[model samples]
Target: MTTMARDPKGYYAVLGLDPEADAEAIRAAYRQRVKVVHPDRDPSTRAREEFRRLMEAYAVLKDVIRRAEYDGVAPAEAGGESDFTPMPVACGTCGSLTAQPRYVVFRTVRSYLIWAKLGRLDGIFCRDCADHAAARASIVSWLWGWWSLPGLILTPFALLANLFGGSKPRRENTRILLRQARAFLGRGDLVLARSLAEQAATFARGPDDRARVAALLRATDGAVSGHHRRLKSRWRPGGRVFLAQALPLLALPVTIAIFVLIAIRPWDQPVSTVAPIAVHPATVGEIRHVAVDGLKLRMAPLPGAPVLTLLDRFTTVEVNAATASPDWVGVRTPAGIEGYVETRALYAGSGSRFKTEWCSDNRGAPPTAGEILSRRVSGDHRLLVHNDGRRDGVVKLKTLAGSTVLSVYVPATFHIGVGGIPDGTYRIEYATGTRYSRGCALFIDEMQASVLPMTVTFHYQSPTATRSLTNIAEVWLSPQSGTVPRPLPLPPDRFAADD
Candidate 1:
């Protein structure tokens, strides 16, 4: 293989896994897939494609010798493309070329804000390889969990159609709303849900249909949002006129309030105390110092080696070992930035060696739940965020308190939030490529709480009510706790298979 082919980026991306995927993670993912789409069981065309990707992922990852050899280079270049096509091997006896399909199937997640529903998503399945069975299974699971009683789902759609000058579709749309209302009632969002079921009751096309929906709502959430006597009396007198002018104004504020809430950041505790010395120095050298800030690590022996934390300008590091590259040295820096910097960049009066990984349990890749206190834009479109670094890493963006900073999403280059992000609701302003452009969309629940940094994938299509468009803050909150940490290409056991 060529030197460039060894990089694992493409291979990991293909598996929808992260470059740092561990061993056990790979096995479990493979096992889950094999049980459903194994060639031995499934025969659907989609199943075949899944079998190919699964086999190929294992084939590249399982070979220890191949993995080590491949790891030396970047894995990002590998793909299920034509260049890496798989050839069918013949059976020893028949010599028949058993056909193997190429490519794999996966789905994309999307999320957006509407009137008052929170953390809403509309998942759009990738029309690639996986079978319907797997897709449907996921939908059923979300129906009970991520979705906020069906009202969030149903109301958003109906209200949207009505808002956009399409009343005819309202009847059909109401059915979608009722089904979700029924679900919300099942889970207990009595107020908002009762209103949804009640609206659905009014929109039923026929008497039987209306009666059935009304009965279901009454039983599940205990009566509609409007009492029968009140509704009847309003129509007899002047209910239509009253609701016409008054309802919209009342609803307008509620709608705006919800949007404002999603934009606000929740609260969290703070990290109290000074930076603890996590490293010790060995040699005695007079290393000069540069600048210091809230940042933990500063100097490095080389480009990719361990970095020692520069507590102040007087700290020194004793060089215990050396490395092939200039980025890192044995004396070490915080988090391992050993390749590019020189020993002079660090204080060498003799304090302590730099800690190997300066990450705190709630820090470094971990996420908490705090409100987004503030946001700022860097000269070249960078996000400078100051979040509550102490407790619950969630920074609710709307409240504009405790944690705060600016963010800029430039289209050409990558724009990332600076520092740490606390999880909760947020009202983020996505950048329009132009200086005069207005912010396009708002996001909420936009982050999942975790201790690991995760990659997020989003699409422009109808994303299944998900967090795609919204929370780009802390990525990847799994279905449940103990779910394997993401970007994990392999299970935590053997690390990743060869490639």
Candidate 2:
């Protein structure tokens, strides 16, 4: 019933019929169109004219002789009432002939969030093949098309259109039908040729169409009948067809469930306690001193192995034997705990006697425990630094702009009070080691620097009208446990750059 904008003067167009429209389609279209444009019911000039054209179209198309004449096909060439044979072409799916062949393109759409794609299958097919193709395309679209923005809007419409016979060739050309009929006739396929000729007679409109279909049908009628093969449905397994139709619908939900289970495993793992390493008796090699504070004695050679205990600087450990990993050495601590420590953390001699090239320099005498090595400006605010560990360190105070405004040297078991600090926020950074490098102005060996997590503020205020108070910040250079904030490690190059 959809209004078609085909040729305005054409009889088929007047009734919204294509050249391929059969008797029933033509009648149905005429009935649907006539109700709206009936001249008697609606007294208008346009309605009267439309009604006249509709009647003319119906009169000619309804009668066999008159319709053939209007289409310019000979009534003799147009088969009789009992000789009905629709267009017969070699079915694309099967080699046998089909009376009704339609050119159809089934479309499918898929979406992946940001992108979308359109797919189609084009063929001149019979009813069964066309249905199969449309079913597959529609199923795939329904499963995947709703995932993206464009597909959500287009997929539903596409599926609906595909379900209803899909789309056919836009232009009607009976010449192609005539040519196919002639080819079949030449090949002595009388049954197929006659069927094609009959279909052509319905659509033939011009001198060329009329001449070709009449000659083909005449030859087919005169030719001797050949082997006739009736059209049958394409052979396909029922189970496979059902599976193919159903799998895509089930696949999406199954795949999503699998992905979700993989992403969030809700199962609990079995719990077990770690067993302690068995102690073995072995000859101890020369004693090695722990060169660094807070050195970890691990149960295995790996850096991430469980820590047996922490070794303080200058703590002595008995070297048992070399482990497979050269970086790690097997040793027994003073507490009889057997473990492995990094080779770099062990010195053959005492901490004071450990020597290196960078440690030998004496460019400037080392500062006293509480001496301020350098000061950019002076103020009443003060900072107290305590080094309770057995390692000497130099602490530097830098402003937010990265300027090193103050530096202090705090030795082992020594506390320092750095005064004359200006009233501003400052970051506390420090380096610790055994030997002080005067040349490098930093600890040379076993050197470690860190920036404290908390910044110190030196805000001065008048407690009363006449009494003034200066803020003081106190800190311990040793690492603290529990809820206390830990200092973040800093690269030696970055720490030395300020000095």
Candidate 3:
């Protein structure tokens, strides 16, 4: 290797070339120097000396053998080789001499509301390289750095800097360029970082260097581009962001209006009119049935006592046995109204009017009555009848309260009755058997007195026995007035006496 002497008048210095310049570089330098100091352009004596020196430098450097021999003798002749040695503080990429303790200012935009000075990078970069590094850093800062209101407001200035910033110097070594690119990346200048990384790959010296540079380029490209894509997606207008910002503002008025309306509306207005229910004071056992509507319940057991409430038909009451009177009964209405009502207005037990009938085994035959062995009136207008041992009997009872019909199955010589009857006339109907039978009779028993007791008898005849005993198959009864008695729709086997 031909090395130049570290002196002012050395041939390399005369041609403005480095000691490591190749033959081609020496020729090019000669040509450029001849243009600057050629006699045709400059007639000065100093120009002629400079021109001669440039020719001499090129002549020795252009020939390989001559340059080698000259280099060997020139360093010693110029006073030993140590003075000519290059400093370690040179740009690894451009190979340009640099001073130590150089500083670079790094600025980053942290967010839309923040701009941060990230301090300085300390290294040995030449002026041109330093400018390039700063430009690349700024580009990355603007591209990927956190954005703030201030940074966003000053985005135009940063863009201008990126577009017309210092140009990057040409580099020969991939490693140096990669180092700077990484520095720019650290500063958040992804665009400039990527550009430098790609340039580094192109300048790579070997396959290994090239592969490393290529990998770096790919990584930078993927990461930076992916990050940029994410940022763009996040800041995209409309959709969820718009709805999130808009819904609360729109709903505020609606919510307020709803509350105001609720607050102002009349809440005390009556929704319904309810007549007060009058409760009556009475004993637990004195249960009285309501026989008619408009039956006034008084506050005391007297006609002149103030009326507390009225009673409806079939409404039950608990009579105050201790307050019983001849003409009035102290009753507690279903509403718990403690008062008095006329004795005729309420009946004992259930106030249900029933239609009853007696039937025989022979269908469609007019029913006849046989002798009643024993008959008595029980509580609540109930009739208990013991029949002579002659036939199977059935008593069908239908209530006026509703379509509630009951069939009593009476075997031969059995006892049965009808109960829960209101104070009303009832027409009794019956069916005859195959033997001599008597016609049906109607009987009315009024339960005016509380302790009224009664018995009943009916006559019948048979040709063979001429006896009063006979089998009674069925019986029927209905109110004598107001509503006519309808035909009993009895089931064919409903009245069959269970053996």
Candidate 4:
């Protein structure tokens, strides 16, 4: 097993484990680690940071040689500088043999040609790579935490020396790898360095990816040792306290040192200059089609007090608010239907009861026809709209063109403020005329891509209860439709009354 380094900032301390912890003890510590640090289980960031360290340390110790090399280093020393030796021969990024290989990076790519023959490269993340990335993310998240020790910042990368993400190098050859790395790093021989680093990486048990990473790192470091300067300073007085920060950097050896240190700290989201969006107000004609328990709503506007009738499955409805009494919400059906029904089976909170109206998966309720038809709302006053119907994966909304059109992406939910649209109905038209249906024409007067910054406020914290939390996120909104409509570039001012 590997011995803990004199580098007080190393992985051993990060996990609070003894350098000599055995496999069973390590496993036991790991279980405890999961309980405290797993993001799904814990609310605090410190636990997650600690967990990454544990994973890293276990990776190195599981190997024989790497562990030995690690143990060989003095515990009080920063980065084993006294043990390091320089090399003379050159190693390339991709190569056969050399005296020194500063680092190596293996990239996996995929490619597909248009009904052609042989292809070259493409971009893909293997399962191990993805997992390592996720684990790395957890460490980064923990470091950039609201309440974390600065010492915890760089430890994750060092710990990563333990994993290539769930994939383990053959345990049998662990000593061989360590022997090679020691020889290579101590003397800086390209051929020897590459060989030893490769061996060390190959024998890594978990996420270390030592050989693969070293090959890449060798080239980048290029005999330049200053990157390790902070590591050197870390060995000074009171250095033990910051060892956690400095040691991890030596393992990963990337230029992200300062950024990572800062990122692993806490941050508050900045408020946007734009105002929050609002839901649409309900109307009469849109709520005609709601049918429940023999209560059928008309699809079109009718005189007030139309007799209550039998409910049908086709009947749609909307509501101004949630159900509290008998637990029913007003729906606007496909036929412009409206009225109240059992809330248990229906969605809640809509201002409009219009059928065939537009709505966003992001929205809490259905919207009105004008609201659905109109898109690209002004964030300055928080665009308002209502949910029209329950059509899964369907984003139906009206545009200023006065036609009931569908959007390319899922529409977000909205609630209207006290005031109505400043100008009731703005007209829109197509510059390119896209075909959405057998007979409908699609337009893109002001088509563009945008992802709105949204937040979900939950009422409770434990298990996502019906309550709301103050947390928010910048949601990515993009086009599901392939093309953007051309611009008509018009206002009432563009056309005269005589024209």
TM per candidate comes to 0.16, 0.28, 0.17, 0.20
Candidate 2 lDDT over residue span 19-41, tens digit each: 55666788899889989998768
Better of 2 and 4 by lDDT: 2
Of 3 and 4, the candidate ranking higher by TM-score? 4
> What is the C-alpha lDDT profile of model 3 across 1-499, one tens digit per residue?
3334433348888887776676567888888889989999999999999888888777767754335334434344454544232212244235553321122233434443455333222223455554555555555655654366565545434433333332222232354556556555655666655766666665676787777677667767755645442211111223443444346445756987989878754442212112362234334467667655578887777778887877654566887545555556677776777877766555443243211112121124323343332222222344454434444443433222212133333444555654543333332322212322111111112111010111122223344754222432223232124533343443222222111
Cα error, residue 48 of model 4, in Å, equals: 66
How accurate locally, in lDDT, is each candidate? 0.36, 0.69, 0.47, 0.36
User: Pick by lDDT: which candidate is best?
Assistant: 2
Tens digits of lDDT, candidate 1, 93-182:
222321211112122222233222322212111111112322332343334322344444453343332222222233443544454455
Any idea how many clashes model 4 has?
114
lDDT of 1 at 40: 73
Q: Report how far residue 179 has shifted in candidate 1, in Å.
A: 3.0
lDDT of 3 at 485: 35
Error of 1 at 319 (Å): 99
| Candidate 2, residue 141: lDDT | 92
The TM-score of predicted model 2 comes to 0.28
